[model samples]
Target: MDSIDLEVLKTAAAWLNAGHRCELVTVIKTWGSSPRPPGAMLAIREGGEIVGSVSGGCIEDDLIASVARDGVSQTAPFLLDYGISADQARRFGLPCGGTIQLAIEPLSGASGLPELLARLGRGETVERRIDLKTGAVTLRGASADSTLHVDGDTLATVHGPRWRLFIIGAGQLSRFLAQVASAMDYRVTVCDPREEYRMGWDLPGVELVHCMPDDLVLEAQLDARSAVVALTHDPKLDDLALMEALKSDAFYVGAIGSRANNAKRRERLKLFDVTEAQLARLHGPVGIYIGSKTPAEIAISILAELTAVKNAVPAELLVPHATAAPMSVAGCVIP
Candidate 1:
């Protein structure tokens, strides 16, 4: 499963390769309440075929209408604005008269999209810079901190998976979680030293490795944009990984277990010099209490909490199920 932006780029590349004229639209800036954030992309073919989105359906509809009427008139990239007036806001469905600025670049060989996709396939976070006037593009390696930047006439957008999810297990639950996370634009890596658990794991786009969890955690260089989830119930695996993950700058470090097991895990971590502050960052019994009784449901629960943290959603707003309650997953009771 590809992320929405990745899907857009891939579709655009396919259309371009087929000798079709394509135009790529990106949200460069937004004011007030906008439907999409900066760096959101939409790809349109010469015949009005579209993939991905900018401002949900309304703005897309307007773009398609313009394309059908104008017949792809713009030869070079240009900046287009929407919702600048009250009537325009109502027409485009921008909330609170929001104004969005877009950089519409007509795609061709100079766009470097195919090569950009190649780099992304190799798991490299890339910074793509577009010369707005000339419709020329260049690509370079980018760090996780890189963001969309419109400097004068040059537009720089970061592409590829900027976030990482390190899962210390290759079990059934990990498969479901990895699929969902990959679609969410997370570079997911699942590690397990046990051969029995690692066998038959064949999910594409997710890296499955046979290695010790602790060593992998140390080598991961987990930063604020990284998340570590230990789903293997084995203490030999989960505890060691949790210790390393908690010590790193990972925004989220979680472990799946029953309440009793979670308490015991925390106690064990203390003996390894895991600080109270680091231990506090650990999310045990990992996931929002949504009464999940299946592996798929549990995956959703865990991702909900993970997304909240990634977005910096306030704690009170989450209303997380921190309290003890009877929950079961895959017919196994989580007491």
Candidate 2:
């Protein structure tokens, strides 16, 4: 599955390749409560067909109508602001006092979108800079921490998978997690040394390796933008991976197990000289308490918690509505 930004870039490239004029609109800045954050994009064909969104439907409608009537006449990029006034905010369905500034760039050969797509295809994070005075663009290697920046004369946006997920098992639940994480634009790798499990893995765009999980964790050199999840129930596999991951800078390190199992895992890690602070970083009983029973639902719940951590949301806000213990069969959760 393609991310929304990827879809926009691909659609814009397709339109340009088919001899159609299109404009790329990206949110550069926002004030107050806006519907979309900075870096949200929209691709508008000359005929007003659009592939992405920058705001609620009302703002899109206006852009489409303007492009359909005017035929993308601009030769250079320009700034367009919306919802600057109370009446305009009402008209655009923006929150009161909300304002969004967009960089509307006319697509052309100078935009370098095809090259951007190619670099992203190679699994490299990229920083794309566009000159506002002209449509010329430059693409260069970027770190995972790169972000969107807009100066007076240039608009820079980070593209590609800036985050990565390292899964320590290639089982059924791992398959679901890999698929969902890929759609969320995470570069995912599932490591399993067992041949029986490795041979059956067939997901596209996800890397599968036949190696020990702990070795892969060390080789990855996980950063703050990375995550580690141990889905295998084996103590040998999950325990070693957890030990290395907990000591790394990975923002979220989790393992799948019941509450009692989680406690046991912590105790075992303690014996390995893992510090209390480092062990505290582990998120066992992995996901938020969503009462999920199936593998797919469990994947959603796990990603929900990961998203919460990524966004710096307080854990107190995610307390389950019911305080009852989760249901399990024979000391194993259904997930």
Listed per model in order, the count of residue pairs whose N, CA or C atoms clash below 3 Å is: 0, 0
The global C-alpha lDDT for each of the candidates, from Candidate 1 onward, is: 0.90, 0.88
Tell me how candidate 1 scores on lDDT.
0.90
Q: What would the TM-scores of all predictions be?
A: 0.96, 0.94
Clashing pairs in 1: none
How far residue 293's Cα lies from its native spot in candidate 2, in Å, is 1.5
> Model 1: what TM-score?
0.96
Which residue pairs show backbone clashes in model 2?
Answer: none
| CA shift of 220, model 1, Å | 1.4
Off by over 4 Å in 2: 320-324, 328-335
